[model samples]
Target: MSALDAATAFAEGLFEELRVNTTDAPGITRAAYGAGEEFAHARVRAAGRELDLDEATDAAGNLYLTLAGTTPQLPGWILGSHMDSVPHGGNYDGAAGVLAGLAVVHALRQEGRRPERNLTVMVIRAEESTWFPVSYLGSRAAFGGLPREALEARRADSGLTLREHMERLGLDPEAVARGKAFLDPARIHGFIEVHIEQGPVLERAGVPLGLVTGIAGSFRYRHGRCLGAYGHSGAVPRAYRQDAVLGFAHLVAALETSWDGLEREGLGATITFGEVATDPVQHAFSKVPGEVGFCLDVRSESEGVLERLHAELMAHADGIAQRRGVRFEFGARTGSTPAILDPALRGELAQAAGRAGLRAIEMPSGAGHDTATFAAQGVPASLIFVRNQHGSHNPLEAMRMEDFAAAVRLLLAFLAGRPA
Candidate 1:
């Protein structure tokens, strides 16, 4: 069989095997540091052993499957992606990249070709950031980017600390906190990640793949609350009332209007109020709501745009609070910085796509990925996005097998060629 055919078959087979780890319902729930995630890791490990590749894990629980090279002294190439998924997520969110890397190794082995430098397939853990508030847990810990406070963070579901969860997974949290690393940056030439685009950009453009220019930074208000007096709905007049719900409602509308204005003025940015809640015990149809809470998330490719958007939100919020006679309590804002992909690596990928007779467009990722963490560490990193029809992080994510084959073809070509 040809390389493409073999890779396609491998991907199908792997997907079938991975299906056992999913829910009996419509989608998968392979959460990080959980049984489903462990099952996925076991599959990767078993497959690597079948291919006669060496396997290892870092202190941070990142799995590495290596194809040895001809030159041991020189830095090698790293191809990687995460293996965990969001709750009831689709089949190919993170699994597609790792499976693609495995297919590449399998084909190279069949062809009896050894790379000039070592090629490692890295399977990182907890890239979804859905279980814990911390993002890129495995990748950040591996590269010494995780902060000390993160170790104490609790998972949203089980409420277990990160350290406790690591211990449950048979990993040493102390070793990770000590900044242990299995992959050295000096010994690594570059990192390349293949992912299904979580948005409809490539599909809209009628392209098979995209060469990512950068990953957008995100800022969030996860615990914002509003306080006002509780009064009888019939007795309280609008002029004398301190309605927290009213203040929150107006704030939402004002912020969205400002966001649209910024977008119209060419300051590309996105704002979302993902959650809003009134005090459960105190809320009733006959009483004015005294307290309200919400979550606000803002994202942009440019930091300047984020700053401006944040300022606008605060200004609008202040005015709304004063007018409604309510107090605003916005919790601490948290976010990750934007990281631009390596230009030289991008050029190489574009050249490789051209040689393979494929058209790949340049785009920015609104969602975060493991590549951003690598790029932040000053490692040469690039991202290849396979065209996806539906959006990701849910069961409806759709990508054609032919498009995945296109991504694998480009990956093999880029990895096989000499470094630029």
Candidate 2:
């Protein structure tokens, strides 16, 4: 069979396995480092064995499957994407990349085609931060981006320290901290990732594939403890009473106004107040100390712009807090990741897309991914995005099967070293 034919068959089989492994009644709930994730790792290892690759697991639970080349001593090409999904997420977001990588490896092996350097397919453990306090745990460890204090950080829901959680999952946190069982920086020649667009860009443009330009860096702010005294709603004077809800609304409005100006500059900046909390009890006679907290997710394609916006937003928060007479504490829940993509690899992806009879456009990814962390570590990395159904990170999230197959074909062509 031709390499493309083999790739198609491999992708179909992998997709079937993914569906069986991930699907639940409400939708796919394979949250990062969850039970479903462990199942995925098992399946991925099996697939690697099928392709006659050597599979190894890192201390962070990231899986690496290597296909030796003619000159194993030289730096090799790497392909990576996370296997963990968001809560109730669609199947394609991360799974597609993994299956695509498997397909590429299978096709290359069938053709007896090997590059001058080795090829490594990496399946990172955690990409979604919804359950885990820290995101990109797997990729960060691989890239040596994890700080020493991270070992002590506790998971929000589980209240277990990262070290304890690693132990529970059969991984050694100390080895991970020491950067053991990770790819050597000098051994990775370049990296590529195939992922769903997670937005409507490609589908709206009627394109089949995207040659990713860069991934957007995020500046996340946790605005917690907006305090206000509660009194009888009917008896308290509106002018004198401090309303935490009103204070939060004011802050949200101010953030929107500021973001509108950024939007005008074509910076693709966004601000989302995704959470809010108030006192649970409702009492007319008792004085309630209302506390409100919300998240500010600011993203930009430019690192410099992201930093400037972060500073500006913090200043705005302080001004709003003082004006509203609310005690405000601003904490950075996550730091910004600068936009990065491998220019040479991106060009190669575009050429591959063209050769595969696929339409390709360069676009920026607004969401966070393991690829961003890898890029930060000086790895030449790029991403390929298939079309998504509406937005992602929801139960109803989906992507076209044909689009996925087309992306796989393009990726196979790229791996086969086909010229434009």
Top lDDT prediction, candidate number: 1
Residue-level lDDT tens digits of model 2 in 302-367 = 887787776776676687667766666666467557667888889887887777778899888888
Q: Whole-model Cα lDDT per candidate? A: 0.87, 0.76
* Candidate 2 segments exceeding 4 Å error: 282-289, 418-420
Reference-based TM-score, model 1? 0.96
lDDT for each residue of candidate 1 in 75-112, tens digit (9 for 90 to 100): 88888898888888888898888998888888888778
Instruction: Give lDDT: candidate 2, residue 317.
Output: 66
* Clash pairs for candidate 1: none
Candidate 2 structure, TM-score to reference: 0.93
| Predicted structure 1: clash tally | 0
Rate residue 1 of model 1 by lDDT.
94
